[model samples]
Structures are given as structure tokens and as C-alpha cells.
Target: MFDSRHIRTFHAVVASGSYSAAARLLGYTQPAITQQMKALERAAGTPLFTRLGRRMQLTEAGESLARHAETILGTLSAAESQLKAYARLRTGRVRLCGFPSANATLVPEALSALAAEHPGVQVELLEGEPPASLRRLERGECDITLAFTYPGLHEEVPDEVVEVRLLEDQLTVLLPTGHALARRRAVHLADLAEERWIAGCPRCRANLLHECAGLGFVPDIRFATDDNLVVQSLVAQGLGVAMMPALVLPSLSLTRVCGRTLEPAARRHISAYVRRDHLRIPATAVVLDMLRQVAANRVGC
Candidate 1:
């Protein structure tokens, strides 16, 4: 029989893609992780990975074993969570994931409150984009993920996952104080077609174009940035206009930029997602309630 620890180490290595990375993530030394993989290979009677330069790739047999390992690990996690359910907030770690904007505005405050109310409960924060956060949640890396949904993107709630809407965030047009539209109370999407735009990313650019096409014309993008703070700073420097969610408005450091709510009330709705398998745990329920309460209080929704 194969040891469960070996199976777990093998899964972590496959998920992380390197022995060193897996070791770091699992809090084990490089040699220990290597030995576990070797033991796993011996138990399975086949090699699991092939080293390619500095990286490692799983073999066909390894991939098949990985699938089974993932299922076994997931089942074990579910079992442990079930056992811990009775403890409620008395103990357990809550892994939370979200983008920087959410981190800036609500995440810290909410986490503080959670810590204060449940001192025995440990909290972990992970920052990333919506797609990445969702992937972490799916991978069991995070217990919960606060993710954003644009206007056209449908809210996808699979049977395995549950999404609770936190807030309906309005989009605001950000412009420098000296810009022509900065003095306006509101701006139409069509009015900015000729103006230079600062996009969030390539995906953001595509999404922006798709949204603006609804208003009759595409934007003239002059810059692209992954950092919203930099985008705001540049807009304050008279760079270009950017549309962003109001939930992140309070975190903007640029005082020279004005945020005007757009017409038709374009918005991104934020949601907290959890694995359906773990939702029944009491600690998970309490944390979810706290998140919902925090959002309702912060946004006054």
C-alpha cells in the first residue's frame, strides 16, 4: 500500500511543477520532497516525472496518478472539514483570495474584524486577478475567493461551488482634474471615443472595447497597466481616462483625478465563492456571514 503522505507530496509537486516549489509550498526540504517522489514512484512501479533542463514534466502514467491523487486529497480534505465543523470558529484557517483593490478597500478591515471576533481562527490572504483567484479556489489552495464579474460575463455557479453576491459595484470614469470631462457630473461612453485611454491589460482592453462598442465606438488606448494605482496616478498626470469599479475608488491615491459615475449605471458585481463540499462546515458558514456583513456595511448595501 502507498503512504498517503507520498501521494500528497506527489500531488503538490505536480500542482506546483517543481520539487523546490512543491517543497516550499509544503514546508518540506528539497531532499525530503525528492525522496517522497521517489518513494511514490517505487510504490506505483513507474516513473512520475521527467526532468527537462530546469523544469519537470509529468509522464502519461504520472498524469493519471495525479488525477487519482487529487480526488483522494480532496476527499480527505472534505473529511477533515467535516470533523472540524463542530468546532465552528474555535479553530481552523480561512484562506481568502482576491485582487489588490479589494484588499485595499474591504479585505483588511474584514479580516481584522474576523480576527478580533474569532481569535482562534487563522486567516490567510492571497492577491490576484479574478480568474487566478477562481483557479486557486478550485485547486483547494484558498477556502474562499472574492472575484469580480463584468457586465457581459455570466455569473457561473457550478454545482460544486456556491457564489454569494457581495456588492453591485458601479463603474466610474477616472480623469485628470485638467481634463475636459473632469468637470462634468457624468460622462457617456460615446463621448470618450476620441480620448486616449489607459487600459488595465490585454484582457481588460478587449473587455473595454467590447463594452464600449455597445455605445457605438471603440476607445483610443494609449497605455496599458496592470496596476490600477499606477493607472490612477497616470490619469492624475493627465495621461488618460480609465473606467473602474467604485468599490476600489476609496483606495485610489490620486487626488487630482475625478471619478464620475457613468450613464446606464455600468457595474461589476463582486462575489465570494466556496466549494459546495465545504459550505456545510460551521466555521465556513460563520466566515461567509462575516464577509457578507462586511460588504453590506462597507458599501451600505
Candidate 2:
């Protein structure tokens, strides 16, 4: 019988395309990966890989074995998830990641609810922008991620990821207390065509440009930063105006800055994403449930 560890290493090597890459993914040295592959070939009674220069190519037997290995590993993973569920979620860890605004807003309430309900479950949190958070989720570094996409600007979620929409986050124009547009019930993008702008991250700035182009004007962005608080501070000091999502607006002081809805209503769709298999994990499911509830309550929906 072959050891599962050897088979797992073989699978990693095939997936990663090189021993060094597999070692990095599996937290093993290159020599260790080489040894495991050798052992696996011996157990199978056939050579599994052929070397073409520096590249490793799987043999016919290796291809057959790889298919079986995937089935075996997938079954094992499902079995482990089932066992954890049978244990009533008394112990297990769920790693969650999210963008900055979601981390500050809905995530806190969801985490609080999770802790109160599942006292025995451990939680880990990571903060990043939407793209980075999604990358972590794909790499298995996070079980779930809170991510957002501007409806007209960002592409749809990838087919491999399972996403659950939480809420629609509306964008608001933030102006200095003494600015001419500060008291408007809603501000049109064209109204601020001549004002200097404070922009957010690259994705946000791109979206701003797209929206402004629709209004027949391009903003003169004088400042750029990913930090929402810094953007607010700049606006507060009368440096420039900015557009921010509703979720991040709560973090800004209203004394020096005021937010008004956009006339055409720019918005983003906020969602939680996970690998399809991760949805079977009880802890992940619980956290997703709590997040949905928090979003519903916040939006009064």
C-alpha cells in the first residue's frame, strides 16, 4: 500500500509543475519532495515522471495515478469535514479575510455574533483589498473572504469561486464642511468637475474615472492613497473632495466632512466568497450565516 503522504506530494508536484514550487506549497524542502516522489514511484512499481531538460512531465502511469490521487484526497477531505461536523463544531479554526471597509463595518458585528454562538470555534482574520483577499482565498490561505466589485467597473466573480451577495454599498460624495456642494441633498459628478479630487486605491480610482467619464468630465486627482481615513483627513482639511462607499463613511468624522448620495447612484456589490468545497465546513458556514444576518440588519432589509 502507498502512503497517503507520498501520494499527496505527487499531487502537489503535478499541480505546481516543479519540485521547488511544490515544496513551497507543501512546506517541505525540494529534497523532501524529490524523496516523496521516488517513494511513490517505487510503491506504484513504475516511473511516474520524465525529465525533459529541467521540466518534469508526468508519464502515462503518473497520469492515471494522479486521477486516482485526486479522488482519494477529495474523499479524505470530505471525510474530515464530516468528522468535524459530527463533533458539533466544538473545536476547529476558520480563517477569514476581508477588505478594509468590510473589516471595519459588517465583519465586526458578524465576528461578535460568531463568538457568542460558537464559543468553542477559533477564528482568524486577515485584512486586504478585494483582489488580494480573493487571491488568498484561491490559495487556501483563507476559508472565506469579504470582497466587493463595482457593478459597472469590475468584472464578475470567477466561475471557480462561490459567492454570496451580502448587500449593495452605495457611493457617496464627501465634501469639506465649507464646500459649496456640502449642503446639497445629492451631488452630480459634473458639479465637481473643476474640484481637485482625492482618490483611493487603483481599482477605486479606475472606477471613479469610468463614472466621471460618463458625466462628460475627468476628475483632476491630486492625491491618491488606499487608506480611507487618510482620504477623509485630506477632504476634512479642504485639500480635495472624494467619493467613498457607505460602509467606509461611518469611519469619517462628520464635523469636518459631510457625505451626500450621488445623483446617478454609483454602487458596489459586496459579497463573501469561498472555495466550493469550503462551504461544507461547519465553522465557515456559521460565519457566512452571521455575515448575511449582519448585512440584512444593517441595510434594514
Candidate 3:
């Protein structure tokens, strides 16, 4: 059996690139670090490192062991963090990731509540689109991810992730205040067939194209941007019309823009997701609860 201490020592050596540096970092003498490395090699029954002049390089076995060691150490660290969080609920860290609109609106409110409730808990926020955020969550880089899926569109969450639906956000059409369509209660996708459109997000743009195709008209997209503010600005300047989520309106200026719900009532389902196995972590649970509460309050649920 390989001792964790020896493995850790080996990891340190690999990280620092030499036994002497590893010893200094691990609080041991160089000779002791050498002894541990030799013991580790013996346990594996193969040479783990090769000396090239003054530098140490990992052999094939060492490279393999290093990869496994990283995974093992990472899992062990996560377990320790979860255990500590369980023991002391108020004093742990939670990593959260979300898209731009949620980061501007929902995340701020939820994090504010979390901070007020548990001052000792450290919260880290990463901004990303739904797909990237979900990927990060799967990679264990984040504890929770705020994601959305267009209800009737081509979007699906992975089965390994547990999604808790927070609210349904309506997709609204944004037109210049002086535009003819601004007088209508709602605009049909076909009615704006000739109008130049500003599109954002690849999946969202695809959804727009799909919906337009259903109406037998391909929208003439004149501008494309991922930035919601820019999309709103272009629409405000009468450059083009745009489809935006209701959640995004709260963050936009909307001074020269009029927003109306889509005629067919397109909606996106916003939800928070966590790995099934990570749901047991206290910090994750706390943040998830806070997120749900904030979402409910925002949607008046």
C-alpha cells in the first residue's frame, strides 16, 4: 500500500521540480524527501523519477502516478472541505457560477442574503454562460450553477445533474419606442419578418431562427452580440429589434425601448443545478436555498 504521505511528497516533488524544493515546501530536509521518493518508487516497484543532470523528470510511471495522485488529492481535499462544512455550517466556502443576466440580478440578491445569514461563509462567483457553467459544475470547479433552458427549444440538462426549477422567464420582443410594432400589445415573429434583428447567444439565436422558421420567415439578422447591454443599445438606437428574456430587462436602461411579450408566449426555464453527489454539502445546500428564495421573491412566487 502506498502511504498518502509518500504520495503527497511525490506530488510536491513533481510540483516543485526538485527534491530540495519539495523538502523546503514540505518542511523536511532534502535527504528525507529523497528517502520518501525512494520508498514511493519501491512501493510501486518501478522507478518514478529520472535525474537529468541537475533536474528531476518524471518517468512514465511517475507521470501516470502523478495524474492519479492529483485526482486522489483533489477528492480528499473536497471530502475534507465537505466534512468541515458539515461540522461548521457557517464557516465554509461555496463557489457559484452563472450567466450575465443572472449575475447582474439574481446572483447579487441571493449572495447578499447569504452574506447576511452566514457572515462566515465565503462565496465566490464566476460568470459564464449556461453550457460553460454546467461544464464547470461537472468538473467540480463550482458548487452551484445558475442555468436556463428554453422550454420548447433545443436545450437539455445532463442527467447526472439535479436541476431545481426556480422560475419561468418570458421572452419579450424589444422594439424602438417610435417603431410601428411598439403600438401593439404583442408582436408576432412573422410580423417582424422584414425588420433587421439583433441576436445574442448562439442557442438563443438558434431558437429565434427556429421560431421564425415555424412562422415561415427567416429573420434578417443585422447585428449579433452576446452582450445584453449592447443588444438593448442597438435596439434603442432603432438599428434593429431584439428578443430578450424578462429577467434581463431589470438590468437594462430600456429608455428608448419598448418591450412586449412574444405573441406565442415563449419562455425559458431558469434553474439552479448541482451534482447529485454534491447536494449533501452544507454550503451548497445553503446557497441553493438562498438562490431559490431570491428567485421566488423576484418572480413573486
Candidate 4:
């Protein structure tokens, strides 16, 4: 059986025109190249090369072998490329869950990139809050879900779930344009006690209250909504202030509400949560890598 190594050595020596040059290209010693050639000639039952004044000249047998080597190598390379393409186009369905805030940018961009690369792969997206998304994943209703941990109120994800941290979305204060705290460089939890707060949802509000209590005061909750857009719109109307993660910044669509980094620097760590047992799937692995890369690029990491 003619091995790939033997064929490769033959191709390299013919292309480089000398054993020393071919050895340099292949990272093999000159003696090793000579040995490979001798082995190949022995297998072929003929002299492949003639020694002429320290240089190598191809015999008729060598010329014939070289032509066959070229075709064989080309065929092998094509086969490898086709295998890679098949893997890239692996047909499967991946169910993904995420919040609307993330859907604004990172989630959608990563999905678009994945779709472009793997057209045969089918992806189903479900939009919901983090806790709901996590539940869906835990129940095996979805393959992966986007999750986040707010300051002082970390949700305990199950040990059976593997979480891949995508990015640290720094928490920012969303205040109206004319608000007193908005004029300053940044606001701390202690600085905004007098103002009313716009909460995201009941769970999000509960999390906010817990985070605020850690800072020593409960914010007066004037309104609450799961919609970040609505929360920003309320803030713009001078209804109340809110905090949002950096993932929500790019597609906020509200010019009146300004996003400023909070003092004492809080951040929500966004991650991809998947069942540990199902990670062997290549479709999920490649998509997860793409999400991490996109998130890192956005945060200057």
C-alpha cells in the first residue's frame, strides 16, 4: 500500500528538485528524505532518481511516479476539503432562547453569521427573559439559552448545565437627558435614592431591589415592564431611571435616554447555557464559538 507520507515525499522532492531542499520544506533531515525516496523506489521495484554530480536527475520511472503522485495528492486534498464542507453543512435543528435586548444585536449577528456559513443547519429562536430561557434549557425544550447574572442577585444555574461566558455586559444607568445625575460623569447606587426606578419585570425588579438593598436603599418603583424599549421610553418621558446591560446599548433606539457606566462598576455576565450531555453536537459548538467571538469584539476584549 502506498502511504500518504511516501507520496508526499516524492511530490516534495520533485517540486524542490533536491533532497536537501525538500527536507527543508517538509521539516525532515536530508538523510530522512533520502531514506523515504529509497523506500519508495524499492516499493516501485525501480530506480526513481539518478545521482549526477551531487544533484538528482529523474529517471523514466521517477517521471512516471511523479505524475501519479501529483494526481493522487490532488485527489486526497479534494477529499479532505469535501469532508470539511460536509461537516460544515451537517443537517440538524438547534433551538436557541434569548431575551429581546440581546436579540437587538449580539444574538442576531451571531445567528446570521452561523446561517451564512452553515446553510443546511436549521435554527429556531425563542424570545424570553433569562430565567424563562434557562428553564426551557433545563427542561430540554431548547438546545441553548442566553443568560445573565446581575449584581448581588446571581441566579443559581443547575450543575448539569454548562455555561460558557460570552461577555461581561457592563451595567449602565439609563437616565433622562435633563436628570441631575445624568450631568455628572457617573452615578452610584447611593447617589440615586430620591429618583423613581423603572424596572424590567417582576423578577428583574426583584433582582434590582436585592442589588439596591445591598447598597442600603430600596428604589421607589414607579413603573415596570419586561420591554427594555418601553423602559427607555418611560425614562425619556421623565417617568423614572433604569439600569441596562451593554448588550442593550447598540439597539436602544432612544436618543433621549443616555447610557452611562455606573459607579462601583457593575456588570452582568452574559453566557450561553446548554445541557452538558448534548455538547457533543458540532452545530452547537461552532455557533457558541461564533457568539463568543462576536461578544468579545463588541466589548473591546
Superpose all Cα atoms of candidate 1 onto the true structure and report the RMSD in Å to 1 decimal.
Answer: 16.8
46-101 in candidate 4: lDDT tens per residue? 99999899889999989998989989999999988866755666656788888777
lDDT of 2 by residue, 1-301 (tens): 8998898899899999999999999999999999889888888999999999999999999999988999999988899886866468766788989888888889889989878888877879898887888888888898999988887645455677898989998999989989988878999888889999999888889899999999899999999998888888999999999999988877776579988899898888888998888788788888899999999986721
**Off by more than 4 A, model 1:** 1-88, 155-157, 201-203, 298-301
* Residue pairs in candidate 2 whose N, alpha carbon or C atoms collide under 3 angstroms: none
**Candidate 4 off by > 4 Å:** 1-86, 151-159
Question: Worst lDDT window (10 residues) for model 1?
Answer: 82-91
Could you say which candidate leads in TM-score? 2
**What residue pairs are clashing in model 4?**
200-225
Stretches > 4 Å off in candidate 3 = 1-86, 153-159
TM-score of 3: 0.69
Ranking by lDDT: 2, 3, 4, 1
Error of 1 at 175 (Å): 0.5
Mind sharing the TM-score for model 4?
0.67
